[model samples]
Target: MIEVQHLTKRYGPFTAVDDVSFKVEPGEILGFLGPNGAGKTTTMRVLTGYMPPTGGKAIVAGFDVFEQPIEAKRRIGYLPETPPLYPDMTVRDYLTFVAKIKGVPRADRKARLDSVMERTRISDMATRHCGKLSKGYRQRVGLAQAILHNPDVLVLDEPTAGLDPKQIIQTRELIKELAGSHTIILSTHILPEVSQTCQRVVIINKGKVVAVDTPDNLTARIRGSETMYVQVDASGADAQGALSQVPGVRQIAVTETRGSVTGFEIDSEPGRDVRRELASAIVTRGWGLLELRPMRMSLEDVFLQLTTQDAAEPEVAHE
Candidate 1:
């Protein structure tokens, strides 16, 4: 349970976070998304009590971050963008140190360290020095520290930033396993990670909250129309003419053709599927259907639409 109300953070003349508000329900995984200078890290820092906000309040597990820093922090685990680690110390020693500092009972520190190491898949690297570990391993070590105390909430900033593809998948699976037991705030620019790992998403831009909802809802809101990409065996102009006559066809764009196959991007009105009509039209007109597939905008497209464009929300993919 995390609640941020009118949270604002400023540095001199620059405002990093401005009157942002959101709530993370218990056992929910919220994906925090934003562009390079969109105040994601600033918000996380404020919530984690790493720094005091210029204005507003942050409550973690029912404890005010500023007024009750100790209790709030004790119930929240934070992993920053850059893993804070002492290179000279082995992974086990580093996590053990973190557990102690985070107030894990001395008698429970060993079992706790071993458990986190195993959870993060860094058990084999327990004896390896933090400095000598690869970027992926280092990230695992950072995660191990964050979970060593098993806090009620976990705030992770780009937890999979430097991992390989396999490592990324493994990390995502681990995160999925932790979902129900720990409320997590995962901040990452990677769209796929958010789509696959988070239950809900929060997109912020220009120091303001743009949208907060399920990824499917956000994408559906932006890509309001059903789009289909078809390659028909006919002259490009002829193909367009045939498709334009389809009952639900709203718009059509002539794209590049491959060999004798002519490519067309067709859009139908909301809640309509024109594939059957498209196929019949091509066949009745004596044209061969080379390919027919739907085109759904990815989360990256949604991110771009909301962050880069002047629009206040994710833009429609149509021209």
Candidate 2:
């Protein structure tokens, strides 16, 4: 488990993280998402005990990061944006060194090293020098080292960086698999990664917490009124006009047109269901209903709305 209470980090006059607070439950994968320069890395650094916060406190697995740095760090496995690799050492040798420093039992170090390398799909590169490995391989090696000790918490800052599409998917799956055994705080600017991999998301902006909630909940909250996408074959008739007359229909606009089939986006009053009336209206006009479905906001849309605009933090379940 990880808890951050009003954590703030400042460098001289500049505040990199401001009054940020959140909690990651045991075995939960929390996505720390934000745009570039949003202080994501700075916050992760403080949480991992790599740097002290200027104000407030951070607790990792029951130990205050600042008060008990060693204890807190022992439970935390960190993979920074850039993989820290020694070029002169082979992957196996480098990970062996890290295992000793991280306190992996000497008797189990070899087994742990082999297992981690296999899990990260880097077994073939074990003999390759860290510096000579490709960018992707180096990233994988960094990941192997991070989990070599099987720490209770993982603080990954862009773990998938420099990885190709296939590698990214592999890394994503590996992170997902590690969730039940490790409390993970994944920091990245990639919107899809949060939506697909994390159970909850903390969207940060300008060094402040803008929103914290599940991806689905955030999408629903962002759309005040329910929206529906309807594709109709109107036989050259005006489908939008007919749909607009339906009860509870607030607004309707043509989103696309192709021959007789026309697509329309319809907005209805909050808590209202206009699909039935809209369908009836279209049917009465002898138009063919090709498609009808509720339109939910994508995570990207929610991210843009919450970060690009001035957003107030909504009440969220911290624990």
> Which predicted model would earn the best TM-score?
1
**Worst lDDT window (10 residues) for model 1?**
310-319
C-alpha RMSD values across all candidates: 3.1, 1.9
**Sequence-dependent TM-score of model 2:** 0.93
TM-score, structure 1 vs. true? 0.95
> Candidate 1's residue-wise lDDT over 1-319, tens digit each?
9999999999999999988888999999999999988999999999999999999999999999999999999999999999999999988888888988899999988888877888899999989999999999999898888888999999999999999999999999988888899999999999988999998898999887888888988888879788999998888887888799999999999887777778888999989888898898889878888899999988888888888777584322211
Candidate 2 lDDT at 315 equals 45
Q: Can you write out model 2's per-residue Cα lDDT over 1-319, one digit (the tens) per residue? A: 8999998889999998999999989999999999999899999999988889999999999999988898988999999989989999999999999999999999999999989999999999989889899999999899998898999999999999889999999999999999999999999888899989999999899889888899888888888899999999984347777788899999888888898889999999999988889888988888899999998889999989888886556345434
Q: In order, how many clashes per candidate?
A: 0, 0
